[model samples]
Target: MSVTVCLGSQFGDEGKGKLVDILANNANLCCRAQGGNNAGHTIVANGKTFDFHILPSGLINPKCINLVGSGCVVHVPSFFKELEALEKHGLNTTERIFISDRAHVVFDLHQLVDGLEEAELANSFIGTTRKGIGPTYSTKMTRSGVRIADIFDPEIFESKLRRLAHGFQRRFGELLKYDLEAEISRYKNYREKLVPYVIDQIPMLNSAKEQKMDILVEGANAIMLDIDYGTYPFVTSSNTGLGGVLTGLNLGWRSIKEVIGVVKAYTTRVGSGPFPSEQLNEIGDKLQGVGQEVGVTTGRKRRCGWLDLVIIKYSHDVNDYTSLNLTKLDVLDDFEEIKVATGYSFQGQKLESFPANPETLAKVDVTYETLPGWKIPTTGAKYFYDLPVNARKYVEFIEKAVGVKIRWIGVGPGRENMISR
Candidate 1:
């Protein structure tokens, strides 16, 4: 009857897929709560590397059922593409995956609008993945978006889609270019292929709850990218925190037994934002090259920096993580020293929490605490005690600061590289 929620505590790319894949083995069901194909998770299991965009990572577990909840926005083409890739990998996907009927669809028109919007912003663009995620959510919030259920009713779907396109045309004028008719024609074929996967999640979840099935909710993006709690204008369109789990899944707070926050040993952020502890020197380059700090979705090089406990603590305040999963610790093995941002100071005065204003955040001076690096490889460590003394102290420092245990430690990219405490 246990329900566990796993989330990224930093600015995403925290290896959540690997953690979810490991945890899914004992679960009956795994659900994706929010985001669209704009989010990505790379999982290595059974000697196969899977890059999941619109699908659940639980598909790695043969016995686990996967669901895409109403809070998610689906890109139909990408969904089928991912499914086909999975099927080609010899995984049986039939009757094992489902999507909520209430989920909104991401149309090609929306993707075009996303590009137009970003181009208009120019240098100050929000650095989106241009997958129509923001545009879809924008239409959704305005009540002009089409849902999964609409596709079955061709007449109604066509009318709504045309109107939605017209609104975008009115907003962007000649800058917006799309073939509405071609997209509609494509959906005609997609509708039949999608019928079996669409479902009313309420009863399905209710049945899981009544039967006391072990449920796992996989959160896309990270708390620092949350629309409400993250750095504004630089943040994603949806809630990426605990609040999303409730709104996205229609699950009660009491049902959740554990909330795990996935934190990378070093901080890395893709796109633009105020990063107080970013190291632009050789250290940054080393971390980037060694850790492969490139975004899974955007393919952009991630800005690397020391561990930012200020960000982690703020994320904890919002998510109330029951435990933490420290990932990519081996990425720091070769460094002579390791640093962590402990707090932020604005104009010589310390700020108690994460700044709401991006301007203030950009200007705040970071206070760092330096620690000795382990200097030894942790990739072969099979247990917590197997790690070097300095490595153990580094993990313990984060635990003591956040007041949460590091339940799991990821030493490398593979599932076998993880150490459970």
Candidate 2:
């Protein structure tokens, strides 16, 4: 069988974990390609909610093998903490989960540097999760970052830790608060705990492909946070789009069989960026309340807005998605009418595509197409036709506008709370 990749069509927290958890049951292996613990996935299964950061959402599937690929940055403490919590939840992950030996390590010193850097920037900060994701990726690119394998050799690990400490001191000095000896001792213990999970993931995944084993690549963050393609200076450090799957997992493009993109019925973004369709009125407030628009990773209140087709179309074009999964449709049940942005007009000029410049995007006027709302409960609907007529029209309109099929429609937060069309 070929690999299937599930990506977020909008910004992060598109309820990808819920969909991945549902899909993971059919796969033999599930791999987290990129991003760090800064991104989170929340899954509701059997009435229990599982929030994952640094761990693959597939961990909920008992028979599936989960691997954290080399494209990720593993924060040792956070990783272990999450692992312990999973064990407490009665999930057996010891034999199924593995971490790439080449994955860069995120230490406490990195978090310190992250906070210090954000403080220095003050107003222009990218609103990071303060999980040291950006700093860890920065160190990886600089080739001075430590890896899971580095901790195996005591001498090498100690020397590397000392060098990293010195580097931080030289760069941030007084702003960084860390004890060298304490950190070194703490890491030595972490190395012991993480030793069992560390392995060469590239060969493992490649061999799986050769054996015809089914695999699923889970992505963190989303298309709009990709460093190269997204809003500059306000995006994540790594590529959060399609190309990232190849670089993150060391897999060939031909191995991919399907790319499924998940999008919420309405748009919600965390952190700082330009959102042309942001609804700052009662409509935005209602959506936020009903949808529970809050970041899973940071717990920050998400900025809610009407759906923007321009952004969704841009995401489709960039990712080349085969199908889309529209989520949180129940959130719009109470409205009499719903507005969806069809295009963007910047400075009185209609733009053909998403603006690349942040300034241009901030000044753009969204051209919206309003449709009658269903104004009825759809939380238990099991089929597309079962939904209210107007609700189906909204879905069809989005499908036609983006020129992609909607394979799944989420009505609630449970595994069974979806309509498969």
Candidate 3:
């Protein structure tokens, strides 16, 4: 079983798409395990760019079959929209793409409740994509969700929509009443487009495993957004970590032999959460500006900070990460000095182990280890040794800090920019 899994190591936007696109060329299949259209992965190829929300980045690879597995909460409209865009750009879903029949559908009520609930939170919204992700998962937890197969059942579809709308109406009536009738009309129209691609993904996925085809499990959000492992109340509803794969794909953890955690050269987080190593300074401003770090899904400015080795190691320790792919090394070209948070000082006491308690996590103070910046353009570097000495040193520091082998480094924006060490 040649299986590989890729996930975000930080708060996300870790350039996972580019790396996935690169690795997808060698793999026969790519499976998206969790989350929904709330996250975006930007992949550039053939001098054109593709922004993926539902489709795996590997969908752009002609030889790789992309599967949306049972764990994902899909926005059918967004999935079709992205498909249209990819097809318009010469990449079609073809017969290789599969959508799990077990996957929950992001219905109109999901969107209405997602947006309306955030509006209700006002000061405390969890910074969701408002693309109906939270609501889709909510329906699944409550066992009232519509699935990919539900689209074909007209009566069941109508009935579920009515039930879900009523649930939302009670929660959001005074806040933002949903246009239930209009939503029904819109989704009835949407079902026409989704019918061709929506499918029972589990059988196809497991069959591929039986045939020993190269299957990859791709995650939607970063590890920091994982519901159980991440910062609670501020976390994404689904699991972004590796454990989600076991449930999302209905596969045991032992089936996955390689787990590649994608970490950015520096740190960037989107939405609101506890960032233990966030840099609130002139350097932070420069980091954000230089990287043009913004949420592709929500268009919100990303929270920039120093690379947190504490979290990187914690990520590996939690997931049993086998290797690391450091992305956005080119973004460090403009920085004068590079900083990596190697330790944390909590309440005047130093700590090495990852905080098991939420209270301890909230109180931990991050401490840094700085390195001399290379300040040289590295967009064209083809090999690890080709990198400048300072860049190599920074890589070494990270390898030492995280104790994971540095396998590849993403030097630029495109799929081709990735280099193996």
Candidate 2, residues 17-132, lDDT tens digits: the string is 98899899999999998998998899999878888999999999999999999899989888888988888888889789999998898989888889999988888888889999
C-alpha positional error of residue 297 in candidate 1 after TM-score superposition, expressed in Å: 1.3
Off by over 4 Å in 3: 356-363
lDDT tens digits, residues 274-361, model 1?
8888999999999999999888888899999999999999999999999999999999999989999999999999999899999999
Error of 2 at 387 (Å): 0.3
Model 3 TM-score, 2 decimals: 0.95
Residues 40-98 of candidate 3 have per-residue lDDT tens digits of 99988989989988888888889888888898988877887888899999986788677
Point to the candidate with the largest TM-score.
Answer: 1
Q: Candidate 1: list runs displaced more than 4 Å.
A: none
* TM-score for all models, in order of appearance: 0.99, 0.98, 0.95
Give the winner by lDDT: 1
lDDT of 2 at 146: 91
Instruction: Determine which window of 10 residues in candidate 2 has minimal summed lDDT.
Output: 187-196
lDDT values, one for every candidate: 0.94, 0.91, 0.84
lDDT of 1: 0.94
